[model samples]
Target: MTDVPAHVHEFDWPDRVVIGTVGLPGSRTFYLQARTGRRIVSITLEKEQSALLAEKIDEILDRLREVEGNRYSVPTSTPVELVDNDPLDTVEEQFRAGTLGIGWDPTTAQIILEAHPLPADLDEAEEFDAAASVNSEMLRVKMPVGTARAFTQRTREVVDAGRPLCTLCGHPIDPDGHTCIIPES
Candidate 1:
């Protein structure tokens, strides 16, 4: 990471400070909050560097959010369509032909159709409905388990923090005596 330019305001305030600077490439804005409870730091870049840094920061933040919560163990379910008589053989054939690609696991499968921005005629979307019917195979599509788990955890956290609810029935429960009853199956 590049260092902040000297011309940028560097304040030693006990509470909070806002700094701005303009360098060779672009300008930057920074907000530094020094509190007894928690310290917060936010930085913003201006032009080309801003876009690049924003993308990098977004990726880093996404990974961090995923890691902060224990949400790496969620399985995503995909819809599998069974065609005619032989589902297994058709799925195998599609996989072998590379038309239907599988992800890290055999469960995650997707139609490998090219959709590039060149040769508009060739870029037409291929309809797989007829092919899927004739193939007589089951489509095994899989979703990213880790991503889904992380998202679910994040959403639950947000809901919990914003509006407290009963863990069992999702109803508004008392903050103090919120008992969760688990019925025997």
Candidate 2:
């Protein structure tokens, strides 16, 4: 058995970072890709994870904007020039993301995102220390306010582009058919 080197694909300021999918809506595979120039890192993620990440990022930015004397320039919406709607570049799955983390960086006024690979031992504790997880492979990304806003905007659009919801049960309707289990009144 050979050892796989623990790699940390970090992008301080990427030119493009977006959540995109491959395949049809119901059977689609979600991916989080970040690129700086020619270097690109793509990590597979679940649809729920992608949606929650975007929501949390927006919540953080919204809170920051409400700060009484906020020195940072937090945009209320994605900058017109920064709005990215292009398809993801050729994806090469580096790993399937298990633990996704996001935070705000005040000093640089950037949003930080980290994606850690699934642990080898499924039974082990899931808590992760980004600084201490040196033996694992992960991707770390930092982006400014404008870029972060754009990311969340694009991500929301991608997530919503999936199967339409059934108004009766609020569940996604399948392409073939949908059996909504309507609740008894």
Which digits, one per residue and each the tens of the lDDT, describe model 2 over residues 106-158? 88999999888865565675674434443578899999999999999999999
Off by over 4 Å in 2: 1-5, 121-134
Best by TM-score: 2
CA lDDT of each prediction against the hidden true structure: 0.28, 0.89
Look at candidate 2 and tell me the lDDT of residue 37.
Answer: 92
> How good is model 2 by TM-score?
0.88
Find the 10 residues in a row with the least total lDDT in model 1. 83-92
Mind giving the per-residue lDDT tens digits that candidate 1 earns over 143-166?
243432332233232223333566
Clashes of each: 4, 0
Model 1 Cα displacement at 139 (Å)? 54
The root-mean-square deviation over C-alpha atoms between each candidate and the true structure, in angstroms, is 24.8, 4.1
